[model samples]
Target: MLSFNTTIRKIHLWLGLTCGLIASFSGLTGSLYVWQPEITAALNPELLKVENVENIKEVTILKSVVSLIETHKDSLNKIFLPYREQQTIAIQFKNGKTNYYHPVTSEFLGEKSASISFFENLLNLHRTLGIPQIGKYIIGTSAIIFFIILITSGVYIWWKAYANNLKKGFKVKWKAKKKKFNFDLHKALGIYFFIPLIIIAFTGSYFTYNAVYKSALKVFDNPNTHLINQQKNKNFSTLNETLLNSNEKYALRAIYFPKDKSGMYRIRYIKDRFIKAGYRKTKEVEINEKGDITTLSDFRFDSNSNRIVAQFYPIHIGEIAGICGRILVFISGMVPLVLLITGFRIYRLKKNKGLKKK
Candidate 1:
């Protein structure tokens, strides 16, 4: 059998050629995604209008908001409660989504989703390539190809450099020729970035195929991080009323009432956000079938888990990295494209020289 090195190189070279454009496009979009907050702020500041709310308990406010939504006859798909320190509570329904009164009282601070307020098409382009089902496959394949290309180039370059006593690796003569310069930059940058690119590739792959990571995390029996459907309680009205009675300090991220006696009412809280930031807090509050708040015993902020599970996707996509982290991703993402360009120039020069000799 041919060695693993030979096989992977072939895969990398062919895949790189086939998918380089897709990879470049995906990377470009990804680079933009990291700066979405800044872009949104610049483009539509009014959408993320600022305001203050003083005298509202999270639970009662949440119930009243839900009731309001019900009166509007909106089909509830998801409910988001408000947390302390954040300005707005959100309720997402299937038919026509609605935003409750912003904590901004006394001033008619209006609300909007895709237009004046809370939506951007650019974001959809970043994640889904602005293409949808077809785009996902393209991006997913690009991610895998990116890794394959890196490894192939890395192995060939490293092996070639070290094979000749490792002494020839450092001296790319500047008195130099264009070929020498091109090859040197290609090799130099590749070495500097092999690790970061690999991390990006693997993490990205997690989104394309989640089963692998899910299984890996399962080895330690720690897969219980996600929540399942809740049991329904007989007294939905009473439970809802009781929860409204409790005091909550954080913005809600998720909310669901169970279907049966053994079920629990689950609510998630996150710091006010339409923008990603460094110092953020998240937690979940659980009101059990017995009207017991099992999360942190008293305040919901102290609840151990995120009211919802934000798995590997965001971190993989570099969204978790606030701002500076995104800039790093932008730099690293552009490297492969640079390599592609320089590598071709060198390859063309070498090919012409070989013909001249013949």
Candidate 2:
């Protein structure tokens, strides 16, 4: 019978071979997603940034934006008003085309291609490879197995090395010969980053299999929650305008207009300033056309479980600490790819040596 350590090594080897391709693809895409906010801002500044916040127009411009929607006529869906001074007005069409305009001038900046937006496409690729439902399950199952491999393999390697010698386990010999160097990279770097790698795997899993995450939330007794208003929809757009004008603390990110007469409009926003709270400290308001505010939800006021669930996005993308956090996440995203390469090298070298000896 195989020894316990030998069996673990075989499992680790096979698991890496089976899942390494998907993991590498995920890491590469996730690295790009880590800089999503900055990329969008940099690529489309005219639509994403304002030159003069001081000369900003009044709420009447919303009416003007609404008028522009008439150009789309029957095809027009709804206009999105961003609270940030730099953000341009977004006009979405029922046909799925999106156009950007200057919030102040209403100048038609450009239209988003139906093919896909850069970050949005990248996000879909990372999450579901642009194939929902089935793709999500595939990625989620792979992520769970990846998580297990990380734990079992990482602990086994660390324990084996320490059993051999303390320094050998903890230190990588920079000046070592090529094979030794590769071996150290696989083991030492893996040990150093084990915890963070586990976190990345878990958060990726949570995003891919949200039902599993929701089920976990039940342990905290935080049931799924949403706002429900008894009143009917009446002039919901005007009500949203009123709310936007009244609030200055939160910056409106997006607005989902009521679909039918009975539907409620959902407005989502982020706190204006903070290192950790920009994404985590979000608020939403659901209002009907009747000008009745039905539901108001804020992360700050959420339960511990709800709040924990809310942090998943920020944590996954390293948005928790702003720029510095993104850098950490970017580097971590590269780790899985690195491990795949180095681990394969070690396996091949050992295999060849054993074959030659035979």
Candidate 3:
């Protein structure tokens, strides 16, 4: 039988030696990402309008804010109406640069960005270094390598502890010598985070490698059936046309509109077909005042594996988890940093001890 970590060990060693810091940095930054709202709130409490406005319409508020912003708008092109869990009708827009405004009262909230964006920058650096094309590949490859290291180290550490039949594997032995202590932390925490870490790695790798998606089509014996497939309708239809034209088979839960050309208004819904085929979507449709869809000739949603793959990253990242899921992932992400610091400290102490004896 092949040894559990025979190959895993080599992979783990190389990744840890080469990219451990990057992995830890990525984890730390990722952990912070889930808490963005908290950071945003803390950074600028004024951004959140606490007044309860019952008569407020999301679109109305968005328009009010858009008009105010447009008065100063330069390169201020498209604006994404903010949709978060809490009360936020701020429309994110750009004007030679980027800014946001309150939809209510058409109040100019002034140009502001979250100090917490630093965390995003850190994460980008950890993930892609804020560059595209070349940067994307760099981060993608590193993420793949990082996944291997996480899996192998986790399995090896778990094995080393379990084979010894040690009852204290999960708990810290604070009184133990340094190296043993770090090993304990690393092993115990690795076991704790194995599943989540694995998920993050897998989802991350999925984003990095396009080949995996191609192979998926062949493996699943279906092309794009699992993905939420939406095609563009060359008919040049408007959003109103789509809304008036098609009768949807399912009740849409949410809708997203693309701000510019080539972008589509994607409506997301769960129908009976979704469970078997994953989620379905309307083809990239046009957008209008009522958020109407494009002409019936506009592309329709295809129940394909490709659409299913689209959901994986969001789901794994806890975006699909709703607020509670994000909290759990946030906690898990932070745990890795503790594990890294404590593990390294323990390792160093042990090394010094061995050197003294030598």
Q: What is the C-alpha local distance difference test score of candidate 3?
A: 0.56
Candidates 2 and 3 compared by lDDT, better number? 2
lDDT of 3 by residue, 288-308 (tens): 444334432211343344455
- Candidate 2 at 300: error in angstroms? 3.2
Candidates ranked by TM-score: 2, 3, 1
Per-candidate clashes come to: 14, 7, 18
Q: What shift in Å separates residue 157 of candidate 1 from its native position after superposition?
A: 2.7
- TM-score of each prediction: 0.66, 0.83, 0.68
What would the per-residue lDDT of candidate 2 be over residues 1-358, giving only the tens digit for each residue? 9998888888888888778667777888998877666667777776666676546544544555556654555455666666532366787877778888876667888877432286778888898877767887677777778878755576776787698687778788999999989888888778777776677778888976777787778687534644232333343356535553544356555657665668776767677522343457776777766666644656655655566778887787777767787887898788888889998998899899999999
Could you give the C-alpha RMSD of every candidate to the true structure, in order shown? Answer: 6.3, 3.9, 6.5
lDDT against the true structure, each candidate: 0.56, 0.70, 0.56
Provide the lowest-lDDT 10-residue window in model 1.
Answer: 300-309
Predicted candidate 1 versus true structure: per-residue lDDT over 233-278, tens digit per residue:
3333454565455444555566764555576667666654344634
Best by lDDT: 2
**Worst ten-residue run, lDDT, model 2?**
227-236
How does model 2 fare in lDDT?
0.70
